[model samples]
Target: MPDITHEEWLRRAESWKVSGAHHIDGADEPGGGATFTVVSPRDGRVLAEVADGGTAEVDAAVAAARRAFDTGPWPRLAPAERGRVLLRIADLLEERREELALTVSLEMGKPVTEAYAIELRAVIGTFRWYGHLADKLTDESPHTPQDALALVTREATGVVGAVVPWNFPLTLAGWKVAPALAAGCTVVLKPSENSPLSALLLGRIATEAGLPPGALNVVAGNGPVAGRALGLHPDVDVLAFTGSTAVGRHFLHYAADSNLKRVWLELGGKSPNIILPDAPDLAKAAATAAWGIFFNQGEMCTAPSRLLVHSSVAEQVTDAIVARADALRVGDPLDPATEMGALVSAGHLGRVLDHVGTGLDEGARLRAGGERTLTGTGGSYLRPTVFDRVAPGMRLSREEIFGPVLSVLTFDDLDEAVALANATEYGLAAGLWTSDLSTAHRVSRALKAGTVWVNCYEEGDLSVPFGGMKQSGNGRDKSVHALEKYTELKTTWIQL
Candidate 1:
């Protein structure tokens, strides 16, 4: 497909009619009297009046899911039959990729190109991948004496409640929903209030792909209302969430307070990207570091926000990164030429600016981009910021700002670099650039992170698992292991 012009994208945006309602039982319904205004970060324009769901809507969605799980054909169908539905969903998503990508770009400030190329690509691939594997899974049988036979089987764990954040709304939801559905579990998905339009569309698409009436439902509301309700729902057998660590803790508490449903969380990160003097290519490492921090406007859970470089190469790498940051084009999300788009919201932009202020107050040198940009456009825009001479104890290094902000800290030796990278409470991901084979092996093993990228950043495949450790959260998101979250093992013993 050829790339569309920016004017063409703007024309399409003008005609795009967005829906704002709770998707339940294969239909759209109005929420309880209240509504929240969704403002696009691209130009701070009001996009739609979304239903503000609460306990009642959550209960309805959960009940629908429960009924589907207990009595509907979705759970009872043969594994191969279920796989066909998932494959159909993937095809449907492909047919409507333009509509979905436009919706995500308008709702969350992601560049339309990225929304098409990266986000939709991931969503389609996930459903297709899980669909292909659905019928391939096999149950286990143990050897026993002739008098007795034992069989162990995997059963769908009833209803699944998935709560995803604003960034990468569709992709993150797919990570949890596709596998759960493939495992034969009905789902009640709660998308963050900031980005709900796309999820609502996805729910409609799933129904068109021939899912049972209640196989998938999407409720849009704030974390305290719909999210909390899903977490505390008694009938939900499993809960999967992707968001902040602070919210992850709330779900854990809600589980303890309710039926103790199995909860899987993929939370925050303050990942470090290290560059050594003996790196294979200093310029390439510097460029990747810039891309790592600035991608998606730096609103990613696995974003490499910390840059730890050996003292011998720190200046060259930092200077290269600053040059790249300055050259990035931040503008309208619908524009194809935009390399960086607006922040998610005005409030988030303010929060990021506050962190920049804190870094300056704490004595870190602001080498580039310390102020707000493009204020006349009424959009939430910030220049990509870089802070050098940062100490390990600084808040800029320790906490997740979740924006296009980078903190560069210099280390003298391999041990010091590894120590700095492992100092964070969040252990979601890390990246190191080195040419020495022995050093790469030793350092990769020493880093306390779920994924360590050697000489690369954010490169991954669907076959491998992705998750976090320590304060970042627990449980994997991708791969066949994700099925473990939505299914349970059952043992049956027969005596002849």
Candidate 2:
């Protein structure tokens, strides 16, 4: 298939002006009172003006979803019927992959090539995977006494409140929506105001793919208003969220106070990449580390922000990492050849720079890329930043900057490395680079993270579960485990 041209992509994006908000009951409803502008991070251009949906809008979407779940045609359809519609949706998504990738890049400032390769591919795969699994997940009867048969069944948690973040909007939305739809649940999705375009377009695509009225909804608004409303809505049976730790906590609180609904959150992280002295190739290790933290402008929740190196190889690894970080190409996200794009926005860029300043104040040495503004750019760009001699308790070490900033710290031994890696309260993910079998096995077992890579960083597969431990929040996002969160398992007993 031919790649989507920049001009064609722009024209298609512009055509989505009327589709930005309140997709409820199979129709678009304009905002009642407030509006917000979605800007392109590449040049601070206004991409579109979206309705800042509030309580009223959220209520309408949720009510629509509830009605669909209770009395609409979506839930009443046979599992095979639902699966057929979802498969059709997958086919439509594949047909427009290039356009969706361009939309993701324009609105979120991700490198276009990376957007196509990473986000779009993953999202399309998610839909196809779940579509196939929908009918296969039907309840089965276990062999037992003739009079007492056990039926193990799974049913959808009605009216899912899916709140996705701006960084990876479509991919995250797919994570929530595909499984929920597969399990026969209707959804009221609230996309982050910063990047609502892709989700809005996805909503339109669902309509074209034969998704019944009210089966899926999208509301574009800020977290304080629309997000809070969805979290607290009584009819919402399950809440699936991906964002910062603070907001995840607030959502949990709201779920408790409002309706005691089931909640699933994939929150923030300060993941560590431990480089041991026995690493096979220092250059490869350094390159993977750079890609792990710097890719997507370090906006991923499970970014490997902390680099724990063995004392013996600290200097060599740090020098290699610095070289790789300096070589990154920073430019406009729309340019197909651009390797690094701007931060999501100027405000987020400023916050990342502020964290760099804090690192300096707390005694971490600014090794490279700490200066802001690439020589010729005016957009929200921050040079890839690296900090050396970072202590465990420093602000840069403890907090998540969510930018192209990396912290380097050294450890004398395996025990020390594991200790340093697990020191943080946030245990989302960790990466270890070592050729020693015992060391890899021991450290991987000891690391307090939900996912660990022995010789790689940020390597994820759809079949494996993805989530976090501790304050990073609970619940898995991918795999069959994710399907469980969207469903409620019921047990039935019979008297013979």
Candidate 3:
């Protein structure tokens, strides 16, 4: 209908203020309830006021979800019926794609183009993927002697509390919520305060799509307030969260202190993007590596913040990467042509710059951009930054700098490359670019991350499992593996 622009986005943002009551038991849409102001990272402007809650709303949401799982018709429905409802939700998401994308852009400060082309598409695809998958789940039967029968059944783990981060809000939330809903588990979703509008809107769209009351809940607030309550609530059977490793650990204690509920965490990463001397195309590898770290302002958990290269080609790759970094367009997020946008908030911008300063002091040479670009619109804009000659022991290479900063490291051999890639405690994802099939196979297996890309970066499919290893956290997010997180297995034996 209308070309994407800041004016049109702001017009809508001003009107969508007052994020309302928690969507518990499927109350008719939302009302005036958002307890906090949602500021647009594009400018220091109040985009909206979203609903906020503490232990009270968390308790109510858990109660509603518990009732839904224990006695509601949702859990009793045929798998096909559940699939149909999820499909309807996917349809509605596409119908409202533009508005949803704009809402995400206004709140999360991602480029509108990426918001529409990448994120919105992925959000819709996830629902449809899980929708179709709903009916595919079946129980297992064990072979037994003639006198007895044994059955292994996977049942809903009951109420789920999902806490999502600001970056990739809806897509990440979908990773947690979709499979859980498909498996018949009710959910209380706590979206990041920095970007709650899309999830809040989803609460309304879901009800319009025929989801039963209490089946899905969206609580908008900070992790300490609403999230702690969700974690500590005895009725919440599972806590599925995607955020920092620090916060993920906090939820563990909440679970231990409460009901010992199951916890599935998709936490932090400093994923490595390695390029061997045999890379088929150094240009392509360099371009892709730059995009991997700078896309979404380098806010991705799997952003490939570290780049390990064979010493033979290290200088060439670094030069190409710096060129790509310097060429990125950084400014207003609402403009469709913008390649990168602001960090999520002013505070986040400070953190990013702080990391850059620390990197400079740690002796990493600044090869490209290393300063914040004031947008003149109060947006938290940062130039795509690159650091060369980064040592493995330096914090610049070790810490997860969740900004548009890339650290270049050199390796003399494949063994050293693999060791450098796996040295980080966080191992959510890794990538390698090479023409050698044997090296690809060998290095892919040696990397201890959950997902490894042989010749690409950040390419994904809903059918694959997404998660981490070691301190990056446990369990998976996408595919059938994710559904397992929301279910409990029970073995039934009967004597005939």
Candidate 4:
């Protein structure tokens, strides 16, 4: 990398901001729109401003998408042709990776290195994966009698409304956009007002990559205004969302209240990280446990916030985890050496602090951290907290606390562990560490989550389907499974 100082990178990020109106149909629209100010959580300074879109902008964007799907060349093109456009988009994103990643860090307060390395890389990979998968989608022909032939195929679901949260803005938006485009659907994406810079830039990149005027559109604003507009838009055939469970329900209501559009959600999680008695390496598991909860400042929906350790090795693992948590460095996100960064906003930081106080009140013993830090500009950073001897009913144990806090609980046997792990209202993702193959298989089946990591945490493969069970929300995000959610099945019968 260049010897780019932190201030220089911050300058680079601010320089890339879009001062124009939202991208509607391959061009910048007029700018009499309401604007949303972007603030840097690292120091509480104004970074940039985005056109705060609402129902009127949403109607225009969705109408553009619907027109592109119904009459434009985008849906009329062959699948491979669409794939080529997506590949071009991937190339453009890869070329401007540093700028996009820096924008995410400035807007959402994650470490720049993580935003670039992990999140942006995944963004490119998702587009590329679906780009390749597009041409491979073929019609299914089932066996039939001599006089009849059955042809089954999938078709696009028209316009998609994608409302993404600030936590993993670009990549989570990728989860919706890639598959929908590959399935030959047009999209109107509403990125969170808190983190709209990258998605707005994406609109220009997609247009530059040879997409049609209305193939992709972006409306940036608060959820109540822009997000609800997408959900309630009659032309929008599907709504894909990634955020809190509290906000996820609003989309369902919008869908029902309007056209009953298909809604795909990847919501919050209070996932379990289990370390069995026969865990291969307790120390290694301990280190991973710390990373599992503390990574991204624990802004991950699939974070293993609830650590369930076998009683035989609970103290050993707990102490090791505490040591690792204490070693984390909380500082400015632009600093490449920093391990943790600030929350996305002051409101989010307050939510996290309130959860910490509730953990103390509910009697979860604070083993490591539970205080605010980096309060010079505003209280945006918190030390990675570890609470031990937590019971089942504690809010920190049962509910989703989307922050860098770990609640450690103990279990005596496999049955008890399964019971405790499956106790939460969420079923997003879970992790287990054990050497025995039988134990791994048995416990994985018993747990009630969409994805389970045996001895690892938050590891993702582009081809694997990702979503959750129960209240963690519906539908898949990656792989061919995601494509299914964006398209509808049709069967054609012909007499020979």
Worst ten-residue run, lDDT, model 2?
A: 10-19
lDDT minimum window of 10 residues, candidate 3: 27-36
Those runs of model 2 whose alpha carbons end farther than 4 Å from true positions after fitting are: 1-18, 138-146, 374-378
Q: Better model by TM-score, 3 or 4?
A: 4
Give lDDT tens digits, candidate 2, residues 1-496.
3575656555765664434666777777786968898888877778787888999989888888999999998987888888888889889988888778878887888987788888988888898888887787667777878889688788878999999999999889999999999888999999988899899888888988999889999988999989999999999999999999999999989998999999998988999999987888888998899888889998988888999998898898889888888888887776666778989888998899899999988899987898766535556888888999999989999998999999999999888888999999898999999888988888889999999998988787778889999988899988888988888888786757
TM-scores for all predictions: 0.99, 0.96, 0.97, 0.98
Q: Which is superior by lDDT, 2 or 4?
A: 4
- lDDT per residue as tens, model 3, 1-496: 3475777765765675534556778973343354778898988898765667777777777888888889998889998889999899999999999888888888889988789888888889999999999998889999999999999999988899999999999998888888999999999999999988888888778888998989998877778988999999999999999999999999999999999999999999999999998899988999999989999999999998999988899899999989888888997887777899999999999988998999989899999998979757888999999999899999988888899999999999889999999999898999999999999999899999999998899887988999999989999988899988999999999998
- The Cα local distance difference test for each model comes to 0.94, 0.87, 0.88, 0.89
- Report model 1's TM-score to 2 decimal places: 0.99
Once model 3 is optimally superposed onto the true structure by TM-score, how far is the C-alpha of residue 314 displaced, in angstroms? 1.3
The candidates, ranked best first by lDDT, are 1, 4, 3, 2
Using lDDT as the measure, the top candidate is: 1
Candidate 1 local lDDT, 282-330, one digit each (tens)? 9999999999999999999899999999999899999999999999999
RMSD of each: 0.9, 2.0, 1.8, 1.3
Model 3: lDDT to the true structure: 0.88
Clashing residue pairs in candidate 4 (N, C-alpha, C atoms within 3 angstroms): none
Sort every candidate by TM-score, greatest first.
Answer: 1, 4, 3, 2
